[model samples]
Target chain A: MAGEIKCNNCGLDNKPGAILCEVCSEPLEVTVGASVPIIASSSAAHTPASAVGIIGRACGLVVGGNVIDREFELPKDDFGFTIGRTDLDQGIIPDVDLTKFAEKVKIGQDVGYTVSRKQAIIIRRMGRLYLRAIGGAKTMIKPQNTDWKELLKDQEEEILVGSRFRFGGSEGYVIFEVV
Target chain B: MQVELTLGQRYLPITDEAEVIFLLRLLRDSQKQSADLALDLRKILDRSGSMDEPADGGLTRIQALKAAVNESLSLLRQGKDRLCIVVFDDTMKVILDPTIVGDINAIKKLIDGVRTGGSTNLSNPLRYTLEDVKPMDGSLPKIIIFTDGNVNAPSAAAEERACLELARQANRLGIPFAVFGTGIDYNEKFLKNMAEVAGHGSYFEHVKQVGAMRLRLEDEMENLKSVQDLDVRIGITAEPVVEILEAFKYVPQQLALPVSGKIVKDEFPGLDVRGQAYLIKTKVHAGKAVGDFKIATIALSWQGVAGAGVKSMNVVVNFTADEKLISPVDKTVRNTVLNTEGTKATLSGQYNRAQTLFTTSGNTGMAKKVETLAKSDEDAKRTLRTVTVTEANKGIIGKKGAK
Candidate 1:
């Protein structure tokens, strides 16, 4: 068997080729390019920044706010990234912390408060980049030179490089691009 | 009629689950011109109460529909092209039987006064249109139904079965049947399936706006006049153990066509000048033998004024152990298979799956194209699904415009 595959989320060793971790249920392998959990959100005690296990080409989120985690990497076996404003009481931190970019530039306010605890998820299904929005303030795509369109709740929309995604029409918007 | 077959890969995999893809293109030898067509067109409108709701620009759906119908009536050639109108709700009624398009004012008045009532029921109208397409002047027979709600006459199942069976009858009778779903609540799957079974037909659209519906109707008429007047039933007969699996259409439009009973109807005037193709994927049990094996046969039978004829061809595949002996895969066939699967995934609301499939098949263009479609209304997606994909099972999916 391939050496004990460690779960990125729970750090438990899972059997080789097991799709999910035996303890945390986080994905154990990169299935369809959308790997598993790299790090939890900044909700509870930060699980040490060393926990981020980037396994492939990483992308960066460019936003106008107090800088935090701009470079987003995926653990080879990570399932997907859960992004939101408040993961504080949720116990688990999201892969991409929207609050990280919420600090107001001048006033120094946590503008991420406008987003829900679980605003949306960016996952790879069948080798494609997909965004599934589920927050109260529905996510909308602000395309270059095109009118902003809403991403229906629970329905997946294709996300491409250079696409600007506004979460809940808040100041915390993400422009995902391959760096 | 003629059929041409192209294979994605000439060699089959040795042991694993093997897929054999064959691209079958259908063609018509007739040189009929657009000027020679004496057209016969039918319109089936749903007068269910929902259609009376206000649409764009303060116009109710029925008013928009009447204006659209009147606009279509003006496009007719007075004494040359013929037309008919069928209005239905819980009960069915052919407001205008098959008639010439000269009396435009009377027809417009009749269309304007179409009262909205009851729920949607399609079976009766489908059956009535099938019976009314008589005196088959040899003009291409096409029936299009516009509805904004679910079938609720007696039962949804009964209505669906009646319409589907009637659609099959339309295929046999050389009548092209199409359905346009105008609202969000209409059953997308049922309408899509109905159009598929109808062979030479199409389904879907947000028929609320008068302009969109007008263009659609005009396009349909122009296509009817330009393409060859023929109806065809294309079926595949394979060895019992050899699975005749799903297919993806390539030439005419990129669509996933899941087949059943090894049969799919393709009415003539299909993809006319551009041609039509369905890349059929099949699973075959092959030994390590390095030789050619004929596994399936394609049968196509068609009837028209020129004459009726049947064409059949055997699908053959070669098995080889030598890696160098395998022929390079046909990119057209490969992309069709993948893009079709991508379209299916998109229809099922799996955008990433579709994108991955498209990218894998080297169809990055299609991958980018679907993103825009992804953000559009349900009506847009449904239109793409039924119009392009349903034609694979059985529908007359022609080019965007007449040649």
Candidate 2:
């Protein structure tokens, strides 16, 4: 019995079954994994059309000001990258998606974003997962039964989480979906 | 973040004069390698609505003044020139205290923010300025009052009395107040009186000509001349029977000319002379037109470094049987001083020498040369020196006084 609702704090419109607002960490009425349909209100229709394309690979999420936007230009070669305002667009993901599913995210769709200096690696195949397991097994051979050991995938790289950082060498949180 | 530039190029930060003074000292010690002479500039700016009146410039009169002030500050790259601003309507407001103008842009913004609206009040600002500017004991302090029109100032006699009292106070404190009137609408008589009472001098000019005024005021601020006495009385000799019309002092402070026409002269008793310097346009008497001309002599009683003493200089003017053909003797004297090869050569030589010193040792020998050249020029040597320094100074001294 899911119903539509808005988050009390931050006034972010969310699904009735949602537990929290994605924009701000405010509690919502809907519970997690609720089967609710989040309807966009008439006022939401007035939202300006965002020009930012879908983030196909890893994209950085910029949470500045009340309106959150994202930069889409991906790193091409082994050179440094800078996020320009020209490359970004404002986006908001419907609250229903956040409350319903954590895994099996819809591709090419906007999702809740956090401004963290972490990159999410695209899981292409089982072979790469297998390779990460092998690398983790060899690096910490004396590790006991801890899921933490399995978390160290071969694709995982060291990352410095601060205001400024190098792109390639560090493993930063990446955006899987873009709107 | 407001900056108040004194005498144009010298920056005076409103937030902290001591900080600016320290910075100036540091610059002089490290870069300029000269004495850490600090400039303490106290400015009284009129904020009456009249200043907001549309002018030929894109902005209003007040806006132009702000621009001029900022332009003046650009030259103070390294110096102990402190700036303070007194903004006034009917009442007075100290927007930026007499501090070193650290940032001229900031001062511009602060000045720009001064919207024009209200009656004129010269007293409050003058009073505040007199109280605010206190130099480092021996340092020189300067107070500059800028206005557009006459004081909506409380009645003439009362205002005059109050201004005189203020001048006396300023005299006691050794602070000199100089005035710059922006437009013709300004009551020259009142401003002149105020300037006299403030123990300084006043000018009447166009707002567009403020740059000239700035130059004259800056000269006075820099050297901080010890005005031994003002209102130096000059009497004419009884021979030539010359009728003096008017006289102006060419102080090298800013503006096209210092106190235009007879603004400052009214304060001093007119020295009726029998010389060529005094030639009235109208005839005194119908038959007396062809009579002998008399010359006027200004007796200057100055308290020089040596002691108190007096000196008399003659100003002669001549009138022919036809009063229309009257000529002033001072004009000839000035022309002689200006066009003469010896005087011109001596002055140019001294100027070149000063320039050489400036280039070689990075010193302001120009100021010293001016002080030296003023001695034989006139009785009010420093005042005249003020007129000779910059375009502003030239304007104060009058075009005839320029050499």
Candidate 3:
């Protein structure tokens, strides 16, 4: 805890020297010293992740693509949410459960469950949010005005203001908006 | 005909030698010339064991193919359009030659009787169909293929190489071609790469589902009908002797142009109104003049149903020492460039590079897709590349080209 910065927003442990919560992009407290470093990281100083969203504004989600019309609110206060199919016996329960989205979805059935237990996750870093593609099945993303493609699991790319995320079987999909 | 040239970031720092992407748009008013083309179209479909598997809407993949083919035959004009049918399993079999579409019932009956057989043989069908796609009665031939399995004749690699060779031949012949890879079993990258090798008027599609194949084929059919006799030759020159990096036919469908030189060039055979815009990459030198300067020139000529004409335009960008004058890249342009570069990486069998490019381009979605495919089978990796590249190019030019 000495070197690590604890974000006042979400409680995920962040890498050392992080100016914002890696999970919830809220700014961590900085100490005033006699000699300030030449510069902080440009993003960490200029546009904290919270700048893109209100302190408590939730992330909007819309699920489509063969799945029934389903919408849910990803609360800003929670650590984060996942998009994946559910397998209860394996203790695999996604935050934004794909199987629960609709009974019409084939992903929930026994035969062709292509969606992984944990496909993608939305979180923040140094006051900026990002989407990390993870899970057993394939994951894809589409920014506003662009066609659907797979999601990248990286630290640099941030989620655009209007973007959609899809994973798992054919019926697995979710559109994301930073409201 | 109209030609306009634009830069990703209009202002370049005068001090540093810069490499920038230039967007070129070609627009034609085709509404007044609504004359339809007399087309010679050929369909090469795969009838392997996998074709019988259940797909969307409870119909078999073969059934979906038949329905799409039947619907297409009904729209063909008897005298104006001719249709050819070929099926491949262990070997290529011709069901019909370039025959005029007279009775829809007869053509449908022929298609309905084509039975599923042995393993997929891609190279033979592609060669047989593309080798003889000469214009009949002044009607240009359009060869469209649909397959749902990998080449199993000798091996996938052997067949893929053979197909690419045949595609190069078709490219030299000015023949138009399109291919659709249905279901997850097919080698999408090989088919796409093969078609792209045939250059002008080549289209590729990844039917993610067998059920969706019908709609995609139908959509492509409409696109084919709309493709009139628009033969275009484009000649582009850079002022400071820039390196022509890459060019893409950005609208309707995203296909990379084969460009190599200080002066870039491209051609099109029977282009459609739905797919006209282009994006080109160049490393241009900014002179010390500082203010506004002309960097390039675009010359375009086309012969279509409306007649033949030539048009040209000058591309201008600012060479500024003032950092304030430099503008951030336009979002649409940035996305397109990334998609193009990512696709290039995928085509070259560089999955990691493709993933990185996609990640940076803001479509992290494709990055993940590439990552998963990067760890799979060789053929599966090829599919990932195919879908990754093909899917990335969708709607890149927008409806009206980049305004």
Candidate 4:
């Protein structure tokens, strides 16, 4: 009953049991009980190890010297994901909650780490991943094998394996690497 | 009617000058015919508890606001112009949909029926207006929002951001949003930020009396009527070494600066009315070796309201630099910069800095500075008149709510 579905209008893949395409929001016509042939055939062609390998790489954040740590597996189907603190009233619930790493911070107070409600975003475009700063606070990125820090604003920079980026100009940073 | 567009400086010697500031002024030979304009005007009136307080001559603030709205409605061309009215407190009620201005009596009656009571929720009504206007085609769109208190529900910061984002969306759709803050209690920064982000809009602060508020509304209505083009965008393509530090439109409206060097181009949006001007401050990092180079090209594209097709114009600034040839000081550009800087300082509650800048620039008198302080920061005004820096600091320490 669970399988990938393709939107005929925009050609975007929808997750298993999705009634509409996530990207285009077009309704899918298939019945809920029916199985998708394309997904079944694709899974049949791949071995279990290859299937595991096909799972997307992950990016994670470490806050307060191991006070809190979490990782999110980047969506293989989507082009990008946003990381920020969540605010339900504003209808902004970022894909990755950076504040989940905070241990004892109050809701509206500066988390001592200074993370913004809407911070940096990671985008995968043109066969490469990029990190961009979209918030008011300062965000800095440091790639592997380089000690220099490059501050990001509304501009985008390439994010590669072993890349490190900090939000809100704090010591806490998130590392992106293949798992 | 003929309109002439000109730049402040066509050539400059860039020696030792890190930043170049200039003005772009638009002038018209004669006023164009206003009979053909088809405009959609939407007004959002605040019905919060504060509006019930008596303002001038025993009339409530809401009553004064209604009178102003009625006067402005009388100015609209009945058959050609469409109007919508929305009143909001913690909740919003759409009193009139986009109706032709022909039914002036009905509109006046509805305006009289707007009563005041609840807390303030500024963002939701704006969102509602956006939704109402988004799908409409072809009429010049404008929204006027009047509020007398801070955004009370859903938190102040969140609502401010939401309003700003709504303004940005409205700007992209060529809809100008003018905001009026009636009293000192309203958040001027929030209202100003909304106006700036809205691009083709103005923010007016009426702190003195209800009659002043009515006059401000009348002036804005006149401005809206005079708009020849609804959306005018100026695009600046600068050299890699050049960076635009700040930009301002009519009456010190600030444009957002580009955040990175990769952004080689930026656009400043405004309404294209006759006698309007735009000022920009840009810095060129022409390190050591510079002889003669073209710095930037400013291009303007606009949608004329009078059935004119999209019009475009371009101006280029070329610079020649040496260790000896320095650029001459331009007074208009200097005064503009000073005005913008003083306004910015006053907004940030640094009254002394604003006073010094305004005094040195000779553009603003001490009385004007005091008036600005009275509207923006009462504490800063008190510091300006009575208290020294040390006394102010001691007062801040002594009182818990001094800020």
Candidate 5:
């Protein structure tokens, strides 16, 4: 009974020694007994001989354009990560680098704007992944067999395999695939 | 004012549930012994061109509005309430300065003389009420705007933004900006957002019927008389791992959660007496181990009627989680979540989703779910014989062609 912790947000009582809230997925700060084991299994926990198995167990993004083609491997960390262009002077290095494409292109009389500096963010919660738009730019997500949904700024949607996303008003698209 | 706080659930089972809803009911003790609070009330009545069109029965829309305003005016305490009347069409006109409610003849004369003709311009009267009318010392200042048409001038988007901004400003100044939309032609979304931003106000929908409209206004006036406190704010302090998903205020409106807070402090505004309830959805991380833990402490602060100093109350809940103990879900909390979520889905035009949630929960009665859905969806009305067209017209009626 001493191990049980109540969630402050939803007022739901949780079993003693829970690290994350059962209801809201919030982190529980209560200490657990020594016998309690952490439920989450990370890639770092693998033995040295099987460490190579975690190499390609990640989601990747492919950005293709008329003259540009690039690939970026998403972080395997459980936490949420940002995807945008890098700003070295400001010490801003995004999880998925797109700095090479963050420029205004001019070909004859046509002009084009690049993806924003803080374009989109992918968050993993309770083993589920979600994508959110940042910097007020429009981000559209198209899941397989579903129409594209405009991911409004700050609105998060779950990402699935075969899902594609485009940022701003640009023509380049990023396909989400497990590699 | 005395405050009583109760939570819908005190125990939750440890599981992988993504969201938990806790319903907080704030009940104000009877204040019959206290004298009526002094109030500075202003009424903004719309007299647009459409007001001349015939409503249900033979009465025009303006005629119905005038009748309702007159009946509601009689309910205000004569000496304690000071009233101002403003009429608007394409522009706003101040027909009466601040006058005592005891002067029924003068008020009635102005109400009878209100004429209908011109495009609907909602921003002018709202701007005037906020900028020109100064608040009386020790008296609650409130502006009630009644309109029956969409705001058509100065561009709809610009007008909506201005109205919302004004509502926010009025809220900061402790002025309640209530808007009443009559008939099906008005922009309910704009009015609802305006009332919500005003913090301590609400948006009311009145069917075009004159008799029902009068009764609704009278009921609103009666409710206004029971104001024990105004402009109430509740501050919640939670542990680092807890996340608040939503906060709802019955007096003002409902708010989707995570409600703009940093790590330690989350604030919910626009609360009032007359028994308001807030359903909060939160998540608590199961930590490394289970032990007795302090979840959250809620501090509610409000200004009592009659210019009483700000009063505060603190409610703290603590629980211990043990794997051996089986925790039954709280039905009251569960029902509240179902109802709130159902209503939210209906308002957002997700009728099928709302119905699916209702059916899956099975905790809420089918009749109640149908009634809730019928409040916003016309299609749902076909299944419920008791639901009237007017009742079904309560929610946002987007633009002419919008879904």
Candidate 6:
């Protein structure tokens, strides 16, 4: 059952371990199922809505509100995040009241509110992962897409039924799947 | 596509997380409907009261409120309308604070932790709420108060005074208030009256039907309108022919002035200010197209300067059409009558009624009170006033453009 995964952007078929499409240089994320069957199962059931809460830490190099350098760090309980002048300059200026942003992303660190445009960038990290689990062990899972509602809702039944669970950490790992 | 908008407006904040979350949720929902809401509950709520009440729901007014509040919280959550509950009996406490109802266990825990007992001091609780709801700068602040009765301790009057001060602060800060009375013994008149004064609505409910109360709360919350740079003021023209006397009131008619304050609205106000252009809407009179009418002058004194400790900016508007000597109402007689009638009715507590006298004349009350329980409070009598002016010659006469 050797199958090839093709890149939509460059129309390139990348190898199992390929980081980028060999033909067009597009980013290619590959997962090996033999070693981690859970990864394949999780991907099949992934939803976009869960991205909001699953996002434990995000490093966005914004140049004008549009993310230029977007990275989701692994969930860590103590890594500090900053939305400095660069973050503000990149596009969306942070307000003193971080309610809107906080709703989209759970804020666990002291956000840099005074960071001016261009001079500051937003480095959002977390102090602890606030996720629910079946036996108290944090799960290591990631969805193919980042839509918050669909992710959370599709997992709602799994979450409320059986030993199924979902969890996140300060390390940016939002894991929740039925094993 | 993500569009970024910059809001330079300033406001106070509530350091308490739950309170902030609760208020913010309410604010976000309201923002979807109206674009000009500017009241910050954080700053006002943070001023007085305990942030946490011991988790216990016993036989007392607090317990009754606990149950009612719990039901309301559920309704808000199920409806996807965010809500927060802050309970203050003898002390201020964040019972449920601000928690989204997606998690069943959290909702159960929040509802189950309701505590009872303590003196009912309304001022501190309200102050704390106002302080805790600092709107995300430029966002209008709105608050809903649920209480058993008047201030509980000997400092009742003092608390009322504090409430008056808070109302003034809310006016300056652009926050509105709504009051709720739970339980039969609760001070319905006082709470309702205060809601009228604070430019918010009021609700009364017994322990049995919190479900009904929840609906009322939802109605008021839904009708809230957001506005920007809304400043209102009153001024006199020629010092009185019939001893013109003095005029006082709450604009948009929901708030009750401290004493003998005339006029009130059971719901929200007009003028949803989401954009920049200041749309000045007022009624004008044409008269017989030939006479002189007396006009009164009014002004909206900007307080942003006061906040910055800078000099205040005052903008003046005349009710008269003719620009005569030293504020004389020597405009067309019919015009003066129409404008003067509006000014009189507004001051006399018939603002909304007067507005309708010309447009529709009959739809007097928007959300009327079903029951009026008596409590012998002089404040209620003083706050009630009626509008008796015709609308044919009505027009808005004030500063058109001043930031």
In order, the Cα lDDT scores of the candidates are 0.58, 0.36, 0.61, 0.54, 0.54, 0.30
C-alpha positional error of residue B37 in candidate 4 after TM-score superposition, expressed in Å: 2.0
Can you write out model 5's per-residue Cα lDDT over B185-259, one digit (the tens) per residue? 777667766776775544444343543456555545545555555556666655556666557543333444346
Native-interface RMSD of candidate 3: 17.7
Q: Per-model i-RMS in Å?
A: 20.9, 38.1, 17.7, 32.0, 22.9, 32.1
Tens digits of per-residue lDDT for model 1, B37-84: 677788889898898787765788888888877887777888887788
Instruction: Point out the higher-scoring one by TM-score: 4 or 5.
Output: 5
Best by lDDT, which number? 3
The chain B TM-scores of all candidates, as shown, are 0.80, 0.49, 0.82, 0.77, 0.80, 0.45
DockQ of each: 0.02, 0.00, 0.03, 0.01, 0.01, 0.01
Question: Among these predicted structures, which one has the highest DockQ?
Answer: 3
What C-alpha RMSD does candidate 6 show over the true interface residues after superposing them?
Answer: 32.1
Candidate 5, which segments miss by more than 4 Å at Cα? Answer: A1-179, B1-20, B31-35, B204-211, B262-273, B304-324, B356-403
Report the lDDT tens digits of candidate 3 across residue range B1-403: 4343445666655633444656665543434353366767788999998999886667888988887778656557786788888999988888988788787798889999988888988778778777664567566577888888988788877877888898898899877677877667776667767777887767676654454454454555555566553678888777764556667775545666666555777787655544455777665544345777766778877776657766777766677767665655544455566677777777777776777666655555566667766676554554564455445644332121110
- Our model 4 lands, by Cα RMSD against the true structure, at 26.5
What are the per-residue Cα lDDT tens digits for candidate 4 across B1-403?
1222322333444443344555554432233443235667788989999998887657888898888787667777778778888999989999998787897888899998888978888788888888855444556677878888998777887878788889888878756776666556877667766876776544434334454455455545554565454345556566677666555554223343444442323332223232344555666565533455545665555555454333333334445443233323433344445545555565566666666554544433332434444454453343333211111111001010000
Q: Is the docking of candidate 5 incorrect, acceptable, medium or high quality?
A: incorrect
Say which docking band candidate 3 falls in.
incorrect
lDDT over C-alpha atoms for residue A15 of model 1: 39
Provide the TM-score for each candidate, comma-separated. Answer: 0.60, 0.36, 0.62, 0.57, 0.59, 0.35
* Predicted candidate 6 versus true structure: per-residue lDDT over A89-122, tens digit per residue: 1112211112122212234663322212211111
For residues B153-251, write the lDDT of model 2, one tens digit per residue. Answer: 666466556766887788666666666665566665566545555443333222234434444453344333223223333232222232322222223
Record all residue pairs in model 4 with backbone atoms less than 3 Å apart, i.e. clashing: none
Query: Per-residue lDDT of A1-179 in model 5, one digit per residue for the tens?
Result: 34357886677777532333578644344421111111212113322323222233355555451213335544232224466765432223455666655556554686644665567776542234567775444578876568888987546776655556766455443444434
The CAPRI category of model 1 is incorrect
In model 1, which regions exceed 4 Å deviation?
A: A1-179, B11-18, B28-37, B91-93, B132-135, B153-174, B200-210, B239-241, B248-274, B304-306, B320-323, B362-365, B375-403
